[model samples]
Target chain A: MKWLPRILGAAMLAGAAGVGIATALEAPAGDPQVVELLSGLNYVPSQSNIDVVLGEGAVEDLIEIAEDSSIDSDPGLRIRAFRSLGQYDGNPQRATAASALRRAIADYGAESSGTKLLYLRASMLSLAAIDGGNAVSNLVTMLGHPSRDIRAACAQALGITGVAAAIQPLRARDLIEPEEQVRLAIADALFLLGSKG
Target chain B: MSVLAATAAMLSLYLASGLACGGAGAGAPCQSHSECDDSYQCLAQVCSPKCTRNSDCGDGFQCNEAGVCNRVFANLGDPCGSEWDCEIGQSCVLEHGDSNDDQKLESSCQEQGEGGRVGSTCIADDDCRDSLCSLGHCSQLCRITDDCPDGNRCESIPRVLGVDDSAFFAGCIEDTSVLSTTIAMSESSGTLRIPVPSSAESFAIVAEVSDKIHLVGVTRVDSPSDFLLFRESDSFEGFLANPIRYARSKEVSTLIFPSNGVQEIEPGVYDVEIEASLPPFGPGTAVPKVSVHYKLRDSHILDLTFYFLNLEDHPCKESMGIDNLDKSSAKNSDVFQDEYLGEIHNIFGYANIVFPEEPEYVNLKRERPDLDGITDEQDLRDLFRLADNEDGLAIFFVRSLPSDGVQTLGTTIPGPPRTPGGPSSGIVVALDSLCYRSWTTLARITAHSMAGQMGLWNNRDPHGITDPIGDSDSSTGNLMYFGEFGGTELSEGQRRVLSLYPGLR
Candidate 1:
């Protein structure tokens, strides 16, 4: 499971290259099937359909589309890519995604304006999905961040990680956590960790 | 702690007992009043001087009306922390309408000198100057809507004191209005489509079913992409046998395409394809499912009355007496109503239980040792006796119910129960003791009753089969989710399903 993300990422990239050719040969770009496939790259892909597209070797294309500067320019499209990228469980290829998302996170922070909460949130979620040692450590560090959303996102990611090591840190954080919503996130994270164990 | 002790620990708050066997301490342990030395009677197992009058206690202390010597902690207009911090029987209330104080009280203990006027917040009747606390508000008691303040009407809400103890409190609350629309096969409206014109800013859908049938609907959005969003009603035989197609939506006709989108969204096309089908009816099985979609644009309301039934030797009812229950249940109901209002829809109407004299029916489970805690034939028979719903939902609060945990907090008949005579009406009998559980659990159980009444099924994952309607990918955060914990919301599908029932009509 620890190695799952990298393996899946590689498989996704290789399979995506083949799928990109196959899909183009099979149907025109605007086809409903194509639309559905492209919709997977859209901000909120259906969970059930996610596996289907990833299995069809569309993961690589999803990555490419997500990374494209033109698409990244659009908040909706960029967030969608980040979101899809975040769903990658254990793919080494996620390093590229992680870096891209990190930049987005940094850019959003630098701008320090507008309604890029969703973008930052999506990036954070992707970072959680593209699990690496750095992702885990960064998320844990976010537990004390000043932003409520960031703290909440970090708590949520830790829970999704299902890492037992997070339990103690979460419990310790909870003692000092002021916000009710953040406390709820930490409690939920603890429950998930305990349940996983 | 013994199992009994643990149960008691979870039951209620108690002043400390066995206080180091010391003297002078207010609630110190003692076998007799003489052990207190300071003259305190052993009331509620605590040694203290019992008094019939205020003159009995010396300076700095007064004999409370309850004949207990309590410190004269604070007086009206005096700053205090809690009611306990004030003189016994005197309530510490938050001073309202002091706008200059940053909406914060500088802290004061005011005498509950007057009866509760309309709109004042209260916990118990004693807190109200008028001696009436209804629905957590200092209600202006009234017999008719005219008696209430302007824009507020009198409602007959139940004063639930205990499982078997209830009384009616006719108090004024804001009036709830429901805008109803019908979903049926008519000559002009053939092919089964409900036009949710963009104009209706907010609304709720309420549908009803009298038989086993598939209620299907397609949410059409007028976006450039015709994303075919499809959902269907659960079948009657499996986990999907629930009638809830959707919970209340945040907005009118907001369809969440789980495949895409952020937050609840109204479809580009304000059109929905609806289809209702029943199993081939051959012998006495043809009940046309009547569905009314109330587009409660801004008024998302579903009213339900809880009838607390008294039964012989029922553990919950017998243990938690009416007065204690009234406070706890009222507090819980207030939270439940507020939760619904905050997350999904507004449950209108009343939040009281009718406590009728005489046991509705003997709880047969107490007599039959072999019956376990699962709700069986006799249980349903007893429950239906108290279910007096001509229409709309009914929550029959009871004492002992079947338990998989400490006790079964809630149980609902998914559809009409099958009997020798045939299937009749069903009831959602929740345990009277549910008031003791966390507010989250109480809310979940109450939501369960509404789901049952609306014909929504439980999320039957432990039972093996996952009903798509009941257990959807969007089940998380949904009120109908399979857990007793966590935040809850109404899914678009759930809202649509709930709208099929004439919940308000």
Candidate 2:
């Protein structure tokens, strides 16, 4: 009976190692220091340092935290993650970060409208920063969001992208935007783009 | 013959004798030299006396090349060469006009009356009658208290633009009145209207919420659709988007109407709405509280409490060692007070700082491991809770902050007024970075952070966004510039926003 109990304990240890191996194969591990810095509040490390420390795992880790929908996750951390992704403006992984942020627009869910709005705003900003030309279409769709704040934020994000394609959609939205604030935002975007040209 | 008729006949006879009329003297209003007394010439609609130099003409009159003492209009906006050339307002400000021609912009007398009356709202100098608009009002220029209207005081204005010493001026500003109240949150979400009195020229609302509430929004009751929204999980972007309306932390928020004193804020009812989460234990839980501090008028006295944090065991302690302030020495030392407090006073002439008690040596590191570095919001909230002081602003001095580049200094943007032990508790200054610099530099950093907490934006942000205050220009010398250290000059509009802080008494 003692031998049988020992064998069962060994079996449990082996299963745990197998699970760890599976996770390692799925994604590269992030440096503990990088994780600690990112998890903390107030200070954000520079993008160059993050890339040097985490290498290719940087974008994957950020995307995972940003897309996390669990109730236990801190909403503030998710927002920070989105912003950090935006710092990778010139990196090759920026495209991947942008795609993840775009997906987060639909995947991220919260009970409170305030939380949802904040997440959407962060995603919009990061997307524009990462790939302005590609982000134009996604931002254009959010111009029709039910919340006026979201629509206004979308228009502002479109202007920040500085892509020529954003100008036409913003001008088109200008005529149809119902809210005064949103309409003003659309007009500002058009003006910004027009000035850039 | 009545007495009036006899007096009129004598005056007519005197005028007919060819002797200059003796009724009007120098500086008196006159239509012609014949209406002035002997030896006095009528110039620019006023009687002027014969003179060789400016000194012989007396004050408010300058000797012209024609050897006559000419009356100086020297009202606000009138061009002038020196203070002596101006009237009661001693300031002869050197202005750079809008004309591309460089010579058109020159020194002009700084006084008030062309745009609007005293106490009227204004956007720029051109909008006021006085040619000098300060704190959204047409403030009269003055050389002394006697020059100001009753109930107002003549205060020195900080020179924010150029280095010219002649540009110095003083303005008349009113004192402040602060009112505080608490609103009980009865439900998950609801709106409450706070009445604003007609006497209020400008107002600020600071709301400190309980743990349960996660969001708050403020707006004029008449215009509910365009409200300022503040969430518990706000980031730097949130604060930047609504600089005067949002706080960095969740437990506290602020909303300043006409933040830069440029916009017109109507005196009426303002609506505040809060959204809270239900207590896990269910309905019988204690109701959440939202403390509100409403301030009216501008120009105030602020109290400060410095907490010297003990970072003996801090992981990121500066290599040079922490310079822990001696509590008793700091309180009694005149040099220490003059270094920082004097700089603040220089920038905001009406702002007075008083230390209610000796500085406290606090050991926040014992409460939390990461407190020595303050890397996150929870850590800051914990530190503030441990060193909570409701009497005034609580400034925590730490060894170092775990940040990159310019973020070594951390503070709540627009701190909650009169609230203690919350997320927006106080300010944290990294002594490591400031130890080697002069105390005046420390004062600049402190003043900049304090102004931010009190409700002021940088003159210009990275996105090329300027503050709503029309008087504030983007210059490195400005106290509200984005840089960590520089000049300590504060614009009149910046002072208005600083005075609106609820913590100011």
Top-scoring candidate (TM-score): 2
Candidate 1, residue A73: lDDT: 39
Candidate 2 lDDT at B290 equals: 56
- Per-residue error for A81 in candidate 1, Å, reads 2.0
TM values, all candidates: 0.29, 0.43
What C-alpha lDDT does candidate 1 achieve relative to the native structure? Answer: 0.42
Against the native complex, each candidate's DockQ, computed on alpha carbons, is 0.01, 0.02
Interface RMSD of each: 25.7, 26.9
The docking category that best describes candidate 2 is: incorrect
* Alpha carbon lDDT at B84, candidate 2: 41
Worst 10 residues of 2 chain B by lDDT: B158-167
lDDT of 1 by residue, B347-395 (tens): 1111111111111222232332222221344444445444444444454
RMSD of each: 27.6, 25.4
Best of the candidates, lDDT? 2
Off by over 4 Å in 1: A1-43, A47-57, A68-72, A90-115, A130-134, A168-172, B1-505
